[model samples]
Target: MDKLALTFELSYYLWGLLTLTIPIAIHLLSKHRGKLVPFAHIALIKVKNSPQLNQARLTQWLLLILRLLMLLVACAILAQLVWSKNADTSANLVLVSNDWLAQSSDAEKQQLFEDLNSSQNSRLFIIDGLNQSLSQRKLESKALLAFQGDTSSTTTPPLNIWANLAEISKTLPKAQKIQLYTTNRLNQFTGQKVAITNPIEWHIKSLPNTLPETKLTASLTIVSDANYQQQLLYVRGALDALATTLPLDLNIEYLDSSLVQEDLDLSQQQSHIIYLADAPLPTELVNSATSIISSEQLQGYTQADFPLTLATKLFAAQTKQWFADNARLSNQQITELPNLDLVNQQQTNTGNAQSLHLWLILILVILFMTERLLSEWPNKHSRQVEGN
Candidate 1:
């Protein structure tokens, strides 16, 4: 049996406790006020203690106490008094990499869902990367409905699981245990692995070698003057590096600015042209190329000043767009793999805390019924006394 801890899921409703005075004030103000009557024969009058009147006064106080109790219980129910367990207590924090979900097969996804459902107190979190920041969102076991479709063409970058883990560790409570479900794709494991004090049980899924074999054909025609030879070298080197990572059979050709012609196959509708010269190319060369990157677009930076990686990425992106039929490959090149065997397997079987709302609701119902019966009891007793 899970060790449950009592907590208020929505403690804001506890503010209603202040309203307990409302019933108290009403009970005090509702006292029966006797009218002052002018009595001429005060010496002949006698006063005696009546048991019925004393019993009636006691019942009124009892009714007041019950009303107060009812109000207090209602507030507790609204506050969602729950019996919950945290990660350190027993619950397991299950973190699922969205990248893994996108790449995983249907059978694998179904198996994951089954595991989550069978786990006693597992909290599911979907790990996603946006703008180089990792954000996690809680998910139910059945929330994988959208993952059943084909998402093979998603262009999102592979997550740096190790770096993300470091960030996650900072925000986690002390001594929490984590069950991480992710792919063991080397590209997904980027950056340095830091030591996390929390115990993590790695459920690493090996990815199949599905690298594309079909090489895309891309041609680049550089039109530049002799003065821009160094700029040409930078462009050429960047493209060479791009070709190795991307499955592309790239072809490069050079043209002198003065030798350009209007009828030249510069805009062959298939090639992308990179103009490196300071002089603007003829309208024919500009209009002919399928896509052109002019000197102005490069920010007029010299070869030494130009950002090679940035230029390469821009070129690679353009190539991918131009040849949409080719398979898009992940740009991350695997360096070193982490030691998965070193991970501690301290997995826990805890789930969401059991809710006490039902019990509170039942108590509220009983309070209402008892309050109604007691409220009528005094009136019923008085009628019987009059009949006597």
Candidate 2:
């Protein structure tokens, strides 16, 4: 198999390269101005040694080169030039979910391995509870045996390992085809949708399992806007009693008017929510709600341009303990593998800019020291005696 390779790409502030002309222009414009004295014979002095003229010309050229190098180095530092090592684009990534090969004959397994080896860039990984690369497992026979002997069954909830799809997505070094091998068990799926920015062509082999559907518990959260202080208190009184009566975990939130318009962030582990607010919610917030109460009992409009509204009932029938008892058994997080949506909302970039800066600094110092040594070497020789 061909080794995993990276291509080198360089990026810098392009305008900095144009500054190279500055040093060359100075070298061309500056000429030695000679103080000439009146003389009877311009030819009296022996013709200046040809060797000395050649040596002086050589010195000027060397000095020009050194000065230009110094300027270029400084510009590079300011431009923050960086080199990026990118993974091979043409390489194929094949994730062999063990379930795909579980029931296949030995001949099929051999054929699959042969097909993979045919492509120089094909890399295979096995995914179940963990993603293990075939390269690391060296012994193909042992790896296949291990896959067949997988004891982490989805039938038992406590023994089952819930593979976090969001976390799995982050482990991917680059965008590639994703394959999942598993039995169709409800416990394996996440409570919420997983949103991945990468465009992965998913190939799944979900073998039907004998396990019954895993029952999930539910949570109820209530949020009220600041303008409705009296309303918030009334809702809390009703729900707080329901929490004790039905033994339900009730989370209550009161947001100020300034903070009310902000979108509420949700996670797979979190409960479905009920929001009571007067202001119009953002598109995302409206879509996330299980239920919303935008107003109360009374409603009226003045004959003029004035608007008036009132509510006769502070707590409705839906806000009672009976509704919460039924809500606890709702199937909010159950789904099959393909349409499963488990979201990992945290985003972090992997680049280390500080490390790059340190490397550039080290190179710049080395170039400065080299230039200094070369500049003073010619003078040191000039100071020595001719016949020493």
Candidate 3:
């Protein structure tokens, strides 16, 4: 657990001591003052009328002691002083998180889950929407359900991460350490305690060499599904990643909107056409195009030519295979391919084990044990002195 200090916590024990001691001292000292009574044989009266000996004073002292004990208990809990000897010693390894991102290819997600599966004594917290649960399994054999539906940012804001971390700390024994496996998205979170030991950042960069305008090309086509009337489709490719945004003359395309936002449903055979005025065909697209139609007939396509091979490779890839094999097909086959710069890359690294941190936690447990014993020793000595 991350330690945070409350300003007035230390003062509670001091207050308790002062409250009890001041009253006791006053009562003891007051006895030294001599007093006179009008009645004869007042010694019996003096014994009965002693000021400190009362049920109310005893109750007050008991309350002060109880308050002090309560404060110490609270402090111990806040400090996570309780350590479980039987807790899994292998490594606390609380799954910081496992999630999917659009930036990652379908293959990357599969490999990532595999890596998580391989970690021994590790818990899995799959972040689909919130976080899904899975029984621990072998890394190689673990099967993860592919993330489907919209790949856009989550609708609601992510769960309170700090609160999640706090809860995780409580669930595990104080002896065990913690680790996080969050995506780059969580890098925004700063100043976290619980010792983030090793965080691996994933970066996927696509290197695209500009194809000469002379390299053969074809028209940019947008495909949609039967249900696409409710959704918007935007044709995004490598050019968007390189520069600010895709550079296409929307005037050539006589469509409702040139800007596509939602995922394009190529499941059904619906296709949107773009017309170009003076743009030459991209090498990838023209080579893949079965029939090249007249240029004047096209109205809404971009004047800037895109590669034909890039389009064919992208459309033929798993993105298209997923739709063809899984998604329901329609009668109309999409012929005009969108400008696509498909990137297929993987990065795998083995993490180094950290055992020194475990030793540090052990030292802390010993310190807490020693402190508890020492605190009780003083009380025992005080009682012995009183008995003597």
Q: Which candidate's lDDT is highest? A: 1
Work out the TM-score per prediction.
0.42, 0.46, 0.28
- Candidate 3 residues lying further than 4 Å off, grouped into runs, are 1-87, 90-130, 133-195, 198-272, 277-388
lDDT of 2 by residue, 130-180 (tens): 444334523343254344533343322211213433444443434434433
The candidate, 2 or 3, that scores higher on TM-score is 2
Clashes of each: 5, 7, 18
Arranged by TM-score, best first: 2, 1, 3
Please give the CA lDDT of all the candidate structures. Answer: 0.67, 0.47, 0.36
Q: For model 3, how does the per-residue alpha-carbon lDDT over 54-115 read when each residue is reduced to its tens digit?
A: 64455445544444444444444433332222335364253423333333456756765666
In candidate 1, what are the lDDT values of residues 9-124, reduced to their tens digit?
Answer: 67799999998999889987888598988878785878788988898888889888888999898999988887665435366678888766777777777887888788887777
Which ten residues in a row are the worst by lDDT in model 3?
A: 343-352
Error at 183, model 1, angstroms: 1.0
Please state every model's RMSD to the true fold in angstroms.
Answer: 11.8, 15.4, 19.0
Candidate 3 local accuracy as lDDT? 0.36
Off by over 4 Å in 1: 1-88, 130-136, 149-151, 154-156, 224-255, 259-388
Candidate 1, poorest ten consecutive residues by summed lDDT: 326-335
